[model samples]
Target chain A: MTDRISNKKNITLSIIAIIVMLAAIYVLDIVIKPTSSWSNLMTCLEKGTIYALVAVSMNLLNGFTGLFSLGQAGFMLIGAYAYAIFAIAPEDRATVYQYYEGGGLIHFSLPHMLQDMMGGADAFGGTIGYYLGIILLMIFAGLITAVIAFLIGIPVLRLKSDYLAIATLGFAEIIRSFFQWEGLGPVTNGSNVLRKFASYDSSIFPVLVAGICVAFIVLLINSSYGRAFKSIRDDEIAAEAMGVNLFKHKELSFVISSFFAGVGGALLAMFQNNINAAPFTSNMTYEILLIVVIGGIGSITGSIIGAYLFVCCSEWWLRGLDAGEFLGIEADFMSPGFRKVVFAVVIMCIVLFYSRGIMGTNEFSWSGLFNFFKTLPKRIAAVPGKIKAKFSNKKHKKHTENVKEAQ
Target chain B: MEFIAKWLPYILAGISVGGQFALIAIGYTMVYGILRLINFAHGDMFMIAGLVMVYMATVLPLWVSVILVLIITVVLGCTIERVAYRPLRSAPRMSIMISAIGVSYFLQNMALYITGGLTRTYPTIDWLQKNITIMGASTKMVTIITPVLTIVLVIALVFLIKRTKIGMAMRAVSRDFDTSALMGIDINRVIAVTFIIGSFLAAVGSILYFSNYTGIMPTSGSMPGLKAFVAAVFGGIGSIPGAVVGAFVIGICENIIKGLGLTTFSDAFTFVLLIVILMVKPTGLFGEKNIDKV
Candidate 1:
């Protein structure tokens, strides 16, 4: 009964926290009217939410299931393209598919189609109906990707670790080229950029979508199924000994993770307001995997923190490392590619030294944060005494130097 | 007769490319055999070898540059093993693989930093570019040269693996990592030798492979490297001859698929083959199956 009460409290508190965080984002964007720094930071947060989702999903497989897959980006590609195809406005389809002259004869808009099914504007009283249709489109994107994952899982789930990595990596490459193929111009718009979809102009759309999806993953991880997956990761033989069906659980974890990756990919597309197959490369997969490693492999909180760290360092603050005119100072050799060099170096250090990463299979504890805050004043109070002692020590040194000179 | 005439050129081309794939696959197979590592950095080493050739051709004559490139690649490969891998010899399989991935990233990004992501043109080889007509199909001299060179090299490698002292040491080491060490075999030296031979073959493969493809990028190695790895798996990973045969089959099938106008999915075709192999055999055509120990 106490456990139930605490669980309820935690849920309510986190929900309240999420609402507060979203409110803060709205205030920053609409009310404060800060400069490019704030705007860039907001963009980073939005992008970070999507990455956090993908990274957490990756963690589900790599950490919990012990299945090292390199196929997240491929699933993301499917989701992004599916969402874009369905939700793109009817009029913009022609402009977007300029290379292929109106995206073939079977063009249809997902939102409008759903709006019609929902009995048009009179039924939901206007644009709300259209918004509901877009949400459904996003869900469909995830479903399509999940179905593909089920098919892909049948062949690939049986392979051991590195073999699985190479196979999935190969699959990603195949998927990328498939989207870029000139012959598929009707459905995929070929190599051309996909645009004018129902994008998340307001940051709330992505936060809600990515947040809810990630929460679902977190809940799944804490369930009995998650325990079974963890057992497989820890000791597959023992897991099998415990009567856990290895193949079934592995497939389930892979498909579920792929579903969330799909949803995250749709969120990413909306954040950027345009989609292209070029960005969904193996490098993207590597980046997300790096986040999973850096964030602490098994911890949900770690992945989120890593996502924010990655976005902030790569997008906002660490921009100074590369910018030639950073802080009005000219640093010539700090060219554009320097950040990538730096990031690679940082990952090497993290992999070598802090392999378990920041969280190390631990979640961020609310009590831990609260306790640190409670102890803050005492540490701050010690600062001035230490400073005074340093000054006195410096004066004593000066007196000793004077005595030496007089002698 | 008309169909044979039309398909014959593709067959020839596939054989030529397959020979190059065989060379690279040998490297992957050897490293996996001895160390039980995928050696992801092997591809990047090949890429660097290509870039070294491009840079060297500008400063020196082609013959000297080629020889110099081979030496540099061998040294680089050995150094990577000594530096990145030797320390992780006793670590978990996961850590070593991650370390290999890190090395690949470092090499690729370093290349990017140096070249600023530009795709550079490969130096033209005049003699290799010479055109020949066979059965109403015209092709370059390298098409004939690549397979001949590959066969000779494979013959030489087979002799080394079967008939030499170092070859015996290599076989013993791959058979059992710790037991061979107990037998007074210099494990480090044997591993270094494996890397040297693998890197040497990759360098040779890069030169001939680029001779046909004609452009070099920072990412040039990744596709061929991956496909050659697939070949290595197809052939039975630890067996050199298996890697060679797998390379040829993949090259031919891939070319035939592309010729069928599914040009967009030719890359996927290799993976499809990999999946099928994983499903049907789990091991390549020649892979030795060992019973798992608890």
Candidate 2:
């Protein structure tokens, strides 16, 4: 009875902690904003929230489920394009604004339904309508991406890890190619979607939507289904023997993960107001993989932590490369590509030394937090002794092996 | 007749490219046969060999540079086996495969960092650049050379595998690693030999490929590597002859698709082919069927 009471208390405390954290984040968002910089701060927060959403979804499949997926960007591309098609104003589509027209295949017409549904040449409605349209478009984009993921996953998921990686990569390339197709240009805007969606502020929406999506994923991860996901990750054979229908669970997780990824992609589209095939390449997938790996695979908090760190590292930390006066470095001394060089090195170093990632599969728990503080001094004191013992054991083993060889 | 006249040259060109692919595909197939691990770094090795050839050409005569590059690449291949793979002999298949990918990424990045992501151009050899006319059709010297060299190499490899004691040891090791070790075969040496031979073939393929393509980049290996891997799978990943056959099929098919004036669909066509093939034959065309023990 006391144990049950304690469990109830624990749940209540966790709920309170979540509320506190959200409140703290909101306060920080406000505090960090300079009087003149309120809009930009909000924009950054929104963008971060969007990345957090995708990272969390990626974590569900790659982290918790142990699936090495490389098609997240592809799904994102799908979502972004879907959102663009559904939400773009009809007037914007028929505009005679040409970027560079010396072309062999210059112009195409939008389908009648797309034209009519977008209110037939007057789709840019009032502010409330536009916002509502954006929300509905994002959801529709998510569902569309989920369906694509389902189709791709059905045949491709039957393959093992490496094969699965290749298959998914192929799927991503196909999707990218599909978007680039001239035949689909009328709807996709075919390398020119940015100009069409220029009026909408994509930055703010990404953060808000991304944040909400991350919260939803967190809730899902803490559920019974999440436990089953972890069980499958720990040992697939054992999980199957335990009556976890492998394909069904994998398909469900993949679809769910991809659905959020599509939404995240929609948010990303809003940020840039441009959807091109180049940024949605394997490199993007690799970047996400790096985030998951650096954060700690199979941990929800880790994915969020990793995504924020990665974005900051890419945006702020690497911003130093451009600061020639501060570092006493000339413009020529710092190659524009130095960020990638550094990022690659960091990934290699992390993989070699801290393969388990920062959180090491452990989530943020109050007890864990208390334990960390309590054990800090003891761990520090014991480090040297542990190192000495490790060396001695290694030496003993080597000596014994030498003696056995000699005999 | 008109279609044949228009498409035959493209088909032939693809076959020549396929021959180059076959050379690379064998390496993938052989390594997978023995280890059950895809050597993702093999493509980078091909890139490195091309770079090595470009460097060697500056110091030596053309034939001498080719020979020297082959020898150096073989040594590099053996060294990679010793350093990266030997220690991980007991690790999980997935870990080793991931390690291979890491190595591939590391090599490609290192190349990019060193070269500043610039495309390296090989010194123009007049003979290689020259076009050869045969039966009212024109083809580059490299195109003809690629197929001839590929055939010679394949024949030599087949003979070596069928007739040599070392080849028997390789077969034994591939069949059963521990049992071969118990039978007094030096597993390490055999594995080293496998890598050396694989790298040698990759070096040869790289040289031929660069001669045809003219410009080589750090990422030049990835597409070819992936295609070769797909070919290896298509032919039955563990079967050498199968890999060669798969390469030709992919090369020819891709070229035909390109010939159809749908260049954008080339990659898609290859993947669709892979999916369709896998659905038909999961173990691949030449792969040995096995009963699932579990």
Candidate 3:
């Protein structure tokens, strides 16, 4: 009964906390213009949310299902392209696909079409229609990606660890190439970048989307299917023995993970206000995997925390280092690439020493926080004594050495 | 005659590039054979070798820089294995692979810092750069030299693996790591030697490869590294000859794809082939199949 009550309380607390966070973000977005020097914070938050979604989806496969897939970038590419192609304004398609004959193909904007049906852009209904249309398009993008993942997963999910990794990586490369191919110029605009799409006006949009998606993921993780996925991760043979249809569960995890990855990719396109196939390389996949690792692998909350920290560090905090001055220390060696080098070294240290990362397969909880705060005084009070004892032990050793010398 | 003339350059280029890939693929195969870990930094080590040669050539003679580059690369490979991989020996396989990736990221960033993200011109040796005509096509001396040199090195390596005591230890270790260790084999030493040999071959491959290309950048090694790894997988991970054959086949097919006016899909073709091969024959062309014991 206590567990149930606490669970209800935790849910209420989390909802309130999310509302406050979103309110703060909305206020900040108004206060800080995009042109401001401190706009990196906004950029980081927006990008962080997107990366968090991708990282969580990756964790679902790698950490929960024991499938080492490196094809997040490919699915994201598909999602981005799917959204970008349809989201492009009809007028802009001419210039966007200028290389193609007859001013490109499929020239109707989904949001515009919705707007027209709801009494045009000046009406409140039209505005609601526009937002709804974008959401629908995002979902459409995700569904398209999920379908592709289902096809790819058919043959790929059967392979073991590293082979799966390479095969998925190869598929990602193939997808990238397909999008860049000149033959697909009519639809994909060849290798040229797709831009001028409908984007969210504020950071609140992505925060809301990513927040809801992560909550869903958490709920899924606590579900029966999630338990089946975990069983497969811990031991495939045992999972099979327990009647967990191995291939079915594996495929389901892959498809679901890919669905969210697609949505994340669409959000990323909105974040950048442009999309291209070239940057979706294996390196991008590595970056996402690293984020998942930095956040403890199997923890949604950890992935979210890790994404923000990674984005803030690389995009905001480390910018000063790249500018040749960090924390008021300016040196000749502190050039453009120095930040990345230092960042890499720090990552290596994390990988080598603190391999469990910030969360270590643990989720954040209100009770855990309460307990920590409850024990804070006692833990802090013992620090001085511990330090004194350590110092005195060293002193005593030195005294013993001196006595020995005298003898 | 027209067809031969038209395709000869692409074929020749394919063989030459394939030879270089084989040299690097051997490193991956040997490392994976014993360690069961993908040494992701191996490619970066190859890149570093090119960068080392570029910088070293400015201060020293070409021949001296060549030797120094080889030594430095070998040292780097061993150091990475020690610092990044050795501590994770008892950890999960994922952690070690992540460590390898971390090392790769570090090396690439280090190179970026040193080179300031500039594409450094690869220093050319006069002999390797000399132009020659083969059949109806003209090419650099390195094109012919690469295959010859690759074959020679592979033969010597094969002999070392087959006829030498160290080779016997390597075979034993790859066959069964724990049993070989319990049977008085110094696992650390054998691993170090394997890294040494791999890095040395990579350094040599870097020299030959850079001689063909115009410039070397921090990220240049990644594509080749990945492709070489694909070759290693194509040939069967643990087999050297398999890696070589896979590399040659992939190289030829890739170039042929480029020649067929599908330049964008050339890189994709390699991956397509990889997926097809993986689906049809998961053990690879020459890979030995192992039965899973539940």
Docking class for model 3 is: medium
DockQ, Cα level, model 1: 0.49
By lDDT, the better pick of 2 and 3 is 3
Clashing pairs in 3: none
Interface RMSD, model 3, angstroms: 1.2
Task: Judging by DockQ against the true structure, name the best candidate.
Answer: 3
* Native-structure RMSD, model 2: 4.8
Candidate 2 structure quality by residue, lDDT tens digits, B1-294: 776678888887898889888989999988988887888789888998888888778888988988988998898888767766776788656456546666676667666755678888876777877998755568888888888888899899988887999999889999889999999999888888889889999999988788887788888887788789889889887888888989999999999989988777787777777777777887788988855554
- Model 1: per-residue Cα lDDT over B211-263, one tens digit each: 78777888888778889999999988899999999999988888887788887
What lDDT tens digits, residue by residue, belong to model 3 across residues A227-309?
Answer: 99999999999999999999999999999999999999999999999999988987788888888888887888788898998
On TM-score, the leading prediction is 3
Instruction: Please report the candidate that would top lDDT against the real structure.
Output: 3
Weakest ten-residue segment in model 1 chain B by summed lDDT: B107-116
Off by over 4 Å in 3: A1-5, A382-407
Score chain B of candidate 2 by TM-score. Answer: 0.96
Off by over 4 Å in 1: A1-16, A31-35, A112-125, A325-332, A370-407
Per-residue lDDT of candidate 3, residues B63-161 (tens digit): 999999999999999999999999999999989988888888889889999999999999889999999999979999999999999999999999999
Error of 2 at A187 (Å): 2.1
- Which model is ahead, 1 or 2, in terms of lDDT? 1
